[model samples]
Target: MGTATLLLPPRARFGGQRLSQSTARWLGRAHQDNVEGDPVARAFDILPRGWPVAAVTRQRDAGDAAGSAWLRADPVHIRPDINGARLLAHGDALGLTVSDADALLPSLKPLFGDAGFPIDAPVPTRWYLRLPEGAELPVLAGPARALGADLFDYLPDGSQGRRWRALLSEAQVVLHNHPHNAARVAAGRTPVNSLWFWGAGRLPDHVRSNFNEMLGGDDAMQAFAEAAGATAAALPERWRTGEGHRLFDLRHVRDLALLDRDWLSPLLADLRSHELDAGTLEFGDGRRFRLERGQRWRLWRRPIQSFVEQSPAGDAPE
Candidate 1:
């Protein structure tokens, strides 16, 4: 609706992954030039890994003698917030009142600064709710979780994509009807986006492996696909939007679907169970809040992204 504002450079690194350096520089220039829209910036940190290469030169020099140099990176889902209410709720979950969350603006640097690689800086701990349409927004901080989603055919076509839209609507319904998630949202618990992670170019093998582990066998895989197709066919036309496609974490695969309704009830019941208690503490004149938990949260521990898409055997599915 408005003139498009670039968020990040087209090539900026997502998560800790190495984005093309040229992209990062372009983003920096955009920021310097006072670009508008969603301010996209890079967050970097040194994650502990199985191997630490002291020098890439020697490794490259070895050539055939060099062992496989592998790098693993976890990706995150990025979204924009168009409304203040969702942003307020996100702040509340992190133990900040909306005003308190808003007040943290001036000290964003020193307070949120980090000391890790790529120049280190504090990663603002907050969840995002992106509207399909872009809009100017206020910063809202909160304890956050993310949902990993893929837009299969999400493009700039005037027509809306049908199947992808139906799947997203279904996912919202499923999440809303579930007592645990609904209650969490009602109580201001920021649900993080379940994002995807990649080691190389293809989908990770662990996806299929995880499904087999959860479903108890591979017999259900094909059946599951058929079931999805049938559900898609039966979906009401009113709910359909044809044009773009999305295949995020919950799009094609979801762990929740693999489990029965009865199986999910107890988990929700436990979160509501009184034995669980959560508390928060604020630091730096209410700039940062730390949530301390005393009870077990089942949904928190489950890896839902793996269930949705089988790791791309050769790059993620389109």
Candidate 2:
């Protein structure tokens, strides 16, 4: 991987998270670049929030969301909270099947349809609302942003979302009473009791990325790569040589252990032998650790954890 810069996203649990041996070693020896932006968005030059991801991912998953405004109406599982309902899980965790979607969506379509919001579920887990060009939208963030968080906090706010809020309430009522939800409850499975509306926008006229190719990303990242004219493919089992700049989006690697086994281990070996030159390991928490072939000799540093490795109780970890 000559001169190819490899980048990874921030770890979700970095505050008290332990790094894998290989990950700890490589990061410990690297120098912090002190970069200050969401690394993934920075890579694609998209905003950290409010990026038109629904339209982008729709282009990949469904192929028909372009040339119009679109918003994700993803199926979600929410639980009641004292404050309000809290978003529990969505997408893959819900195990949404086409049959499940078929069982749930029919009664809800006319609600949006009558209100001039055309909706469809091109894929089982991903649904889209094709809003008219003249329609207005509030900030419709992705469901991931609200995972395990209070749903009302992330819901569209104020007058802009009044119509959406009303429709969403109606949809929730419909899903809550559906026979499918009862069957799911009987089967010990969580019901897809709500819909998440987010990523609202039309596909942009242009988008670009510095990387020549992208590795290991979801539909949205693939769409970003495609829109920017960059080649994309599944992440390989191990690091390999490549022709141009390559990006490995690690957000999907929920477990840091897999990151060490599949990536950081191989990276350290290659970087030491000059098989891989230099690159940056960027985290979303505003730190990009930089290292090169020659710099790999620093074995004096201890295993690093998190961005700064501070303890939760204001003491360093043993």
Best by lDDT: 2
Compared with the true structure, the alpha-carbon lDDT of candidate 2 equals 0.74
TM-score versus the correct structure, for each prediction: 0.18, 0.84
Which residue pairs come into collision in candidate 2? none
Q: Which ten residues in a row have the lowest lDDT in candidate 1?
A: 1-10
**Alpha carbon deviation, residue 243, candidate 2 (Å):** 4.0
- Candidate 1 structure lDDT: 0.22
What would the TM-score be for candidate 2 when compared with the true structure?
0.84
Which parts of model 2 have CA positions greater than 4 angstroms off?
A: 2-26, 45-50, 237-241, 252-258, 297-318
RMSD of each: 27.0, 4.5
- For model 1, how does the per-residue alpha-carbon lDDT over 1-318 read when each residue is reduced to its tens digit? 001111112111111232233222221221111222211111001122111211111122222212322211111222435421121222223443333323332222222122111111121322111112232212221112222222222211223334223433443343334454344457775432221111111111111111111111111122222222311122121111122221101111122222212222222232244321221111111111111222222222212121112112121112
